[model samples]
Target: MKYSLLILTLLLTFSMANAQKIYSVDYENQADVKVFVVDYANQADLKVFKVKYQNQAGKNNGKWFFTKYANQAEKKIFFVKYQNQADLKIFFVDYKNQAGWQKNFKKSLLY
Candidate 1:
């Protein structure tokens, strides 16, 4: 029973760490991740889909929910003017099914 409880706690912690509750910060220093929107999906590290509800957000799968307040967000991001300055390059996708990371190696950036 103790081992089961430990496993459950670890699972919950991992899920919460990958939550797509994002907040846009005004400055780069305030952000947990620096992002740049790419012109094309092929050029992107991740393809993002904006969700209307927080419950609809994905777990490191690129389905994002933009929180109104910074405190409400799981991850705070800053938009970089140039692609070179970004930690993650993303392209906004029209459909939720298309939202996902193209480069799995950079997945740790969100965590």
Candidate 2:
């Protein structure tokens, strides 16, 4: 029973490691992912929803929690002015259900 509990703890830790906890860095050089906000949903690689809590964040599925600290985030991103300079393109959606990948090929950038 003790060993099972330990395994569960380990599994949870590894699972949370990929949680969409994001930190926006001031500098592009400090970013793990360079992102661009697209004007239209069809132009985006991912349709994102901003979750209110860390627990509400998705597993690289576009539901992100913007962390107050960089250390708390799984991935740090910088917003680029142009789409050409971005590693990923995203469009913010009003509803949580609207959040998801439009083009999954760029999904590994967050992972």
Candidate 3:
């Protein structure tokens, strides 16, 4: 019984540790851009990506996509483009401060 309890406790602890929250931000006005937030234990990474529009005739449709990866120690932001048509911009901010990176996204982007 004691061993079973210990095992259960360990499982729960591990489950909790593995659970992390990630955030993504996309705007209706700009449907081609994307932002991602990757969270770590000590740091986090913010990644941004822009999507290509099908028809660029009348209006420019660009959206921002965002996501967060939690529990990462070394926060690094990166952007990748395939055909050079789409671009991305990443920004990293501290996680501790109330008005820090995470909060900033929530307030600014309403995420």
Candidate 4:
């Protein structure tokens, strides 16, 4: 039973590690989510934390790791010229603990 539990835990962790990889696109029209980088954390609908490892990234809690290729990304994001045109507005928080969705309604955009 202990070995079975360990196997299950490892499988879950491995699957999660490959999830939530993001790609930034040059054009807003090509994006799954049109995003705006807010100047202040208070101005954001989400507070993002850029994780160094892909295993550390998660859904809607603002943990992101950018991938170099679009094919490798689970989410493709484009930066909008205006905040009003954005589907999601985010601020890059300095601390990992500060990362999360400020607006619950916008959570679906990331997931």
Candidate 5:
């Protein structure tokens, strides 16, 4: 039981560390991930939830906090003009309950 618990904890820690890093780029060409903000959740590939604290940021689960500077961010994202031009498309949900990735294939774009 102790070994299982240890493995679970390690998995959680590794996943968290692999996630929780995001940056916004000034230009789309410079970004490692190109994203688009959809007007509605139904139109989005991912539903995002912006958290108040940086530590709260998680995987494709959408707990994000926009940092004041790019240097403080973990993953740099560029906003694309069109959804077709984006590597991942997202929508900001009003509530945390609405957050998650619709297309799991694009989930790696954030990490």
Candidate 6:
């Protein structure tokens, strides 16, 4: 009975390890404007897009939206509408992988 319990515990632990989430972040700068791209796990049905922005009090805010990516007649990409400010910064958040949100920009970008 003790050995059976041990085997069951090991099986649960292995299953939990394999079920992990993955996320990626990309940035682009053109003509003094910066854009951030966040890509998560791609399945057959849906995709997630997120945009992060910094408010006047130096706090970060984010919004998430989803759209169909496969087998659709029209392809759409969501964009954020914010005032044109040279001081805005971007970051990404990944909760499923046990990774905390991180700033994607350098210190110099804040200025």
TM-score of each: 0.83, 0.85, 0.23, 0.83, 0.75, 0.22
Give all candidates' CA lDDT scores: 0.92, 0.92, 0.31, 0.86, 0.79, 0.30
Q: How many residue pairs clash per model?
A: 0, 0, 31, 0, 3, 0
> Ten consecutive residues with minimal summed lDDT in candidate 5?
13-22
Arrange candidates by TM-score, descending: 2, 1, 4, 5, 3, 6
Q: Which one wins by TM-score: 2 or 6?
A: 2
Per-residue lDDT for 67-95 in model 4, tens only? 89998788899998799998999999888
* Tens-place lDDT digits, model 6, residues 1-111: 999999999986664333212222222222222433334422101122242311111111222222232222111222234424323333334532322224444333322
10 residues in a row with least lDDT, candidate 6 = 53-62
Give candidates' CA RMSD values in order.
4.4, 2.6, 15.5, 3.4, 5.1, 15.9
Per-residue lDDT of candidate 1, residues 23-111 (tens digit)? 99999999999999999999999999999877678888999999999998989999999999999999999999999999999999987
Clash count, predicted structure 4? 0
Off by over 4 Å in 2: 1-18
Candidate 6 backbone overlaps, count: 0
Clashes of 2: 0
Candidate 4: misplaced stretches above 4 Å?
1-18
Residue-wise lDDT of candidate 2 within 6-69, one digit each (tens)? 9999988876775799999999999999999999999999999998877678898999999999
Error of 4 at 73 (Å): 1.2
Question: How far out, in Å, is residue 53 in model 6?
Answer: 33
